[model samples]
Target: MTDLERFKNILNEHREELEKEYSISNMGLFGSYVRDDQEKGSDLDILVEFSQPISLLRFVSLKRRLSQLLDVEVDLVMKKALKPRVGERILAEVVYI
Candidate 1:
């Protein structure tokens, strides 16, 4: 399978654990990986939705956990924090897992 497929599978497999630990209600993959245009250093772009407010520390922990799980750098973003225009484009192509 492709790296992207592996990443999606890994995340789906750990979805329950991550949701319980991070209060994440939903997650989606976007950016270069989604477009199949990623370079060697491209980080996985994940748009995450939390079920409740979480501290910055917890957010960072989530990012780190995902990076470890996928064995790739993770650029996590809060779905609620997205700007209108950018969000539209991202949401357009995002693949939720």
Candidate 2:
């Protein structure tokens, strides 16, 4: 199967685990995978929306869970809102909700 397909399966398999651990409102795959060019060395960019701000400890735990499941370099970020801001620039590789 293609990487995107594999990603979807992974998402499906871990949906419940993610919700239980992070109290996530929504999760989506972006970057290369969304563009359909994910490869062995390609990283996964996941955008996560949470109902409320998560503590550092909680976020770490959630990251650990995701890392274990995917066994790849997982880049997880959180945003207060799902909507992208006009002229909003994100400098860092990781953003937390």
Candidate 3:
């Protein structure tokens, strides 16, 4: 399978646990991975919407856990934290998980 498919499967495999643990309302994959142009050592970009705001500690924990799960470095962004123009572009390309 392609790397994208592998990533998606990994995320989906842990989706329920991640959502409950992190209070996530929605989650998606974005950036280089979504565009299918990730190079060696590329970071995984993920966007998330939480059911409620999470503490910075919890956010960091989530990011770490994701990186461990996928065996790739993760760049996690919250939906509520995005800037307008950039948010639009990211949302347009995001593949919802």
- Candidate 1 matches the true fold with a TM-score of 0.98
Write the residue-wise lDDT of candidate 1 on 37-92 in tens digits: 99999999999999999999999999999999999999999999999999999999
Candidate 2: segments with Cα more than 4 A from true spot: 81-97
Better of 1 and 2 by TM-score: 1
Kindly report which residue stretches of model 3 are placed more than 4 angstroms away from their true locations once superposed: none
* Model 1 CA deviation exceeding 4 Å by range: none
Query: Candidate 3 residues 1-97, lDDT tens each?
Result: 9877899999999999999999999999999988999999999999999999899999999999999999999999999899999999999999998
In model 3, pairs of residues that clash are none
Per-candidate TM-score against the hidden true structure: 0.98, 0.71, 0.97
- What overall lDDT goes with each candidate model? 0.95, 0.68, 0.94
lDDT of 2 by residue, 11-57 (tens): 78878867877788877666666666677788777777787778889
Question: What value does the lDDT take at residue 29 in candidate 3?
Answer: 94
